[model samples]
Target: MKNNFFYGYSKQADLPEKKRLLFTEFMKNNVKINQADSATLLTGVLAPPAAMAAKKAGESLPQLKMIKNVPDVLFVPSATVVALITVRFSKRLFMRN
Candidate 1:
């Protein structure tokens, strides 16, 4: 039987030193980006529904009249920004040693 170039390198530890380092760095960056992207997506998805609920609730309360008058186009971006900042701030606050 003939052996392929990658036949024995099944695990990351089996990779050459330089390649292993590069792979590890790539994975770390990928995970960080994935987490950021997930947060952004979650905020984006939740913002609209939240705005709608607020608008509905505001209709029955004089104190929330400002919420009822705000347009969705403006509300969504602002809500997303606030949500992302909250997520990042809370992570920093609680994830410390």
Candidate 2:
């Protein structure tokens, strides 16, 4: 029942044999950031801002100028969704072994 914070497990014996082996294997492996993961992280970080900028640019065109309050109408909810996605992605990205 001991809490081993250093190794991130409560007790080795409490874990099932299969899980214990998997945990040990995971701990033994070297943790390196995957390039694809880095790319996904970068895209997540940049996407919202890039979308906003593009939306603004599109709004500035004469034909597109008829639409007003696009930020309030579109970007607000989209930004919220993007923010939520980024938060979730960041948690996964940072928690990866």
Among all candidates shown, the one with the greatest TM-score:
1
For candidate 2, the 10 contiguous residues with the lowest summed lDDT are 3-12
| Cα-based RMSD of candidate 2 | 11.0
RMSD of each: 10.8, 11.0
Identify the candidate with maximal lDDT: 1
Model 2 per-residue lDDT tens digits across residues 16-84: 885677676666674665455555567666767777776777788888785555655577558657766
Model 1 spans with C-alpha error above 4 angstroms: 1-41
With candidate 2 superimposed using the best TM-score fit, by how many Å does residue 13's alpha carbon deviate from the native?
22
Candidate 2 at residue 17, lDDT?
Answer: 83
List clashing residue pairs in candidate 2.
none
* Predicted structure 1: lDDT: 0.69
**Candidate 1 lDDT, 13-58, residue by residue in tens:** 5458856776576567556543455765787688677866766777
- Steric collisions counted per model: 0, 0
Global lDDT of each candidate: 0.69, 0.66
